[model samples]
Target chain A: MKSAQRTTRRPLALAVAALVGLPLALSACGTSTAASSSEAVTEISVMDYYNNEPDKSFIGDALTKCGTQAGVTIKRETVPGKSLISKVLQQSSSKTLPDVLMLDNPDLQQIAATGALAPLSDFKISTDNFAEGVLSAGTYKDKVYGLAPTVNTIALFYNKDILDKAGVTPPTTWDELKAAAAKLTAGEQYGLAFNANPTYEGTWQFLPVMWSNGGDEKKIDTKETEQALQLWTDLVKSGSVSSSALNWTQADVKDQFMAGKAAMMVNGPWQIPALDKQPTLQYGVVKIPVREAGQTSVAPLGGEVWTVPQTGNKARQAKAAEVIACLNSDENQMSMAKVRNTIPSKTTLAEKFAAENPKLATFTELIKTARARTGELGADWPAQATKIYTAIQTALTGNASPADALKQAQGQ
Target chain B: MSLTTDLSQTAAPSSGKASRKHGRPAGPPTEAQAPRRRTRQRRERIFQWLFLVPAVVYMALFFGYPVVKNVVMSFQDYTTATFFTGEAPWVGLANYVTVLSSSLFSTSLLNTALFTIGSILGQFVIGLALAIFFQRKFPLNGILRSLLLLPWLLPLIVSSAVWRWILDKDSGALNRFLGDLGVINTGVPWLTSTSLALIAVVGVNIWIGIPFNLTILYGGLQEIPDELYEAGSLDGATGWKAFRHITWPMLRPVVSVVLVLGVVYTLKVLDIILGLTNGGPANSTQTIATQSYDLSFHEFKFGEGAALGNVLVIISLVFAVLYLRASRRAVDE
Candidate 1:
């Protein structure tokens, strides 16, 4: 009787154990199958955040073209812009990072510092002829880990009809900008619009103003930065710019411009295709204003760079590097630059690209003198960027004066 | 008569003692029969436990694992690099200390309190009023009651997007309506100004929470028997008097449940605020949940984020305990 009881209990226990173990074992096998199936070098996966139209198609075309050159079929994946870094980190931890990964310029340093990306030199890829700012953006500790074919920066985009009616010629100096914005303010419309929300986009929009005035991110609590902050505050206080600028994104700013609610906006060239879609909207682009007449405008560089992540597969990494090289080739660079309304990263191609696309001349000119955000601080740029936007929010919302806001944001 | 006699016999203490005295006399059987009977009872108990095994395993895998992992992570120096290096050295309570001492901690705590309290009060009062109103017979009452749940049916992100457009200063419907009514020449900066952002956010949250509160409270109101109100009304209790004596005391359990759940849900609200203002206009709307998300996803400080998340969980746990106690007392009464 005792042995029979034991036999019944043992089988029941075994059944319960098998019930739990089956699913776990199946999942483990599933992951192993996916890992082992990629042994052949016929195909490599690429991931990026170009999930929007025109960019989605444009990037697709470039990847397909590059895949042909590298003799490998490409499997592409795209995630939303904001979740890309988190997804990359997850993939890194799982040891399943994509062969070719696209990272936004400012994020490259942080991701590269993780030791998950192979330096371009490892694959014998040359970094020559790339623009200095983008080169520095993709570099980590003196080694280039990524390359960008085309780059972009923000400029002053104005409504031609509104400016023509208001007799404004797109202000080039700070005083001129203030007066023009004030003069253009009318019923149901503000004179200018720009993003000052508490995000990196807001910080990006403020960089041209700050850098043009000789403000340095390394020392954020300076008189120059204060002056820049005060300019934005004065615009809000005088009612020349909308108080809602604090909530608007760069996209929202463009919407306001297209809606005829604002005459001028500080925006980037990424909006060119959208603007062109509105046939009745006449707009012009110019460099963002400087503090004085003689000072040159210095905008921050904006773009995405392609890198070969360490996937622990030598052949796949080599193929990914070839694709990256093909994407950054001179011919592909010029073609992508024109189609994307961005300037080529190679200086030699910029003049030709600009000559072909006259509408983006202002952006091309601005790109020549653009500065990379991570140039000075590298991985520490995000902290400073946060501080800058915090100061902007504090000053614009009347929480503190510009100088005091900067001081407080610097935690002094 | 027989059923009544059986019930009385079972209820009597003498009958229970008599049964105990005769427990084995009538059931005396051979040893084989007794072992088989015991084995059969044991098998029945095992079968009952088999029904609970799936739920136990699920709880262990889902809730149990993440919570334990979070508690462990909070004590480590986890960052972006840690993903590659896998070298998250334990730092004791350093993460908690850093998060608790940060300047934003107090501000976030205050905002969380204000947001939760302001949202709960607004949601409960308005929801209760609506629930009471719907209790009255009217035309299309059922349809109207279900229609009111549309806000709850829509995704939070969608609602946030709709609210963002509605609250815009220039082209928004609210501002345009106000302007047409000659309320003010300039549009109110609903989401841009620091003074108004928290209020606007709270208002939006209240709007989102009303349907949930209304549904639960309405169900609770329905469970109260009509005879109770009829009885109360017979004793000069009508309208306010009836509600004061009958509805209030009977609805206590449901009210406690709703309030505690509301507090827990409101405490971790991130999507609406993030979609609308992103804790902007100088951090006027920054709550602990949003701050934790920022620390983890945005700043890649997973350890600090876990620490902040644990703090929020502790707060929720306190409210949960109070709820359990209140519910138990209600049951006892």
Candidate 2:
């Protein structure tokens, strides 16, 4: 009986070992070797979060072209946008960071603060000719750590057919926007749609409204910010904008506009491809309205900046920096901006881009005056972003007045 | 007897050869046999423990290590910079204080309790009714029972995505169906309203959990002897009376098992709520699990996130201990 039980138990123990040991053994096999000065570098790895179509292929082709120019093969990895930062931190601790890394503009300062990226000046890369906001977004502590080839910002998108039927041109100021939105409201259709969900996207959408009104992220509980919050509250309260906007994402707002449920939407130029697909939908772009007629509209900048991560491989890092510079060349930037519907980071290229692509002219104009979200707060931007979105949600849900909501969030 | 002889031989091959050469008899024990027998038993005990080594090591590597690491992380000032600099100063309960004292903590804790209790109650009552109905004689009962398992089989993320469209305010199927019936004029903000989001999330969880509860309860129902029901009928205990007296008493063990497992599973439900409302419209559906994820991933406050995660684990541990006690008592009865 003992011998028989031993035979049966031996297999069970072996099965358990195989089940647990296989993953451990496979994970242990991932040891990587960085190129030493003694050996010539041959391949460089790149990582980004453009895991979706069109942009994925577009970025892939650019990387391939640049890799050829830099005399190295590129091994690129794409992850979901939401998981990119965590993945970077994981790779950083493991000493397996990719050679070239792409980060969203606002996230640059946080990662750079970790000392995981090499400054572009280390390679003597020229940073001149880039727009002020573009350059500021890539700089951490007066050192440029990354550079974006193209940049974009949010603008107002209106359905031409619906607006024409309503006999209303696009509004240029806050009061006019409110009046137009109210007049355009009708059965089963909201006049305007934008995101106010309790997330960073909500904060991004609210930035233009706040900043254009001279509200500062540093001091959010002020009359300037409260007036901006009041405008958002008024839109939802007057039945012109849907209260569901508190839960809608930018993508959802775009869907509402395309379906004719919303006559106007606050969106970005990246949504142009989807809007262009509907031939029946004649949409026109304009700058987001300012508080008063003469005030300059200040939208938040949006784009990804490419950097060379500190991988302890000087040879490979140099090659990676060259690839980044190639990606940001004037010729590559212009062609990329045209294909991706973004404005070039360099002001000179942006003028040619706007003239060539009339559809993105408003976005190009908005990018010139756009403010980087992290320009003032640096790595501390996320905490302020959370407070802003919380205030927006509270005011929109009728839980508190705009002034009290800001006060409550600020007090926390 | 031969088994003992075989064990002794394997334990001491040199002594076995000497005895075999001398052609010693097996059964009658001399003075030397006592010591040899003791050594053989010791060897057997060692062999038995050797079989458990693999399982113990596996548990330590996978389960024990992570739990210890999480507890350690909760007390340190780990952040994005810690990944590179490897410098996490000992903050000592600061994370716990911040996480527990924050305004959202009370809301999330209450939401977690409401979500768990609401999901389990709805799932159990409806599931028990369906199981008892299916227990009766009916045609196509086997196929119908298998068909009910569809909701339990699909991935939670996929189900939540489909349900999001169905619960949408303006264009959802539920609103359209209700409008046709003149139930209401405007669409109900099922997932958007602060007052209703938690209920909507609980309702979805209950839908997903029903199949699991039904399958387990049905098996428990099958284990019960039919003679009890027959005897109860002769005693004039039929239908509801029969269930109350016979089925209910027999099914207690299964009920406790199902309820404990359901509570543990429902406490960590993050994907469904995240996919639907994302703790939005004023954070009406933010459970502890989702809040922990938001802290770690969204806010990048790893230390506070770990503290919140440990709090959840403590809650689950309490339920686990209760389950073990209940199961032990059930065995005794």
Best by DockQ: 2
Clashing pairs in 2: none
**What's every prediction's RMSD, in angstroms?**
6.3, 4.6
A-chain TM-score, model 1: 0.91
Model 1, range A54-86, lDDT digits (tens) per residue? 889999999999999889999999999988998
List model 1 lDDT by residue over B91-210, tens digit each: 999999999998889999999999999999999999999999999999999999999999899999999999999999888888999989999787888999898899999999999999
Q: In model 1, state the lDDT of residue B89.
A: 91
For residue B227, give model 1's deviation from the true position in Å: 1.6
Complex DockQ, candidate 2:
0.33
The candidate scoring highest on TM-score is 2
Give residue B327's lDDT in candidate 2 (0 to 100): 93
Instruction: Enumerate the candidates' DockQ scores in order.
Output: 0.30, 0.33
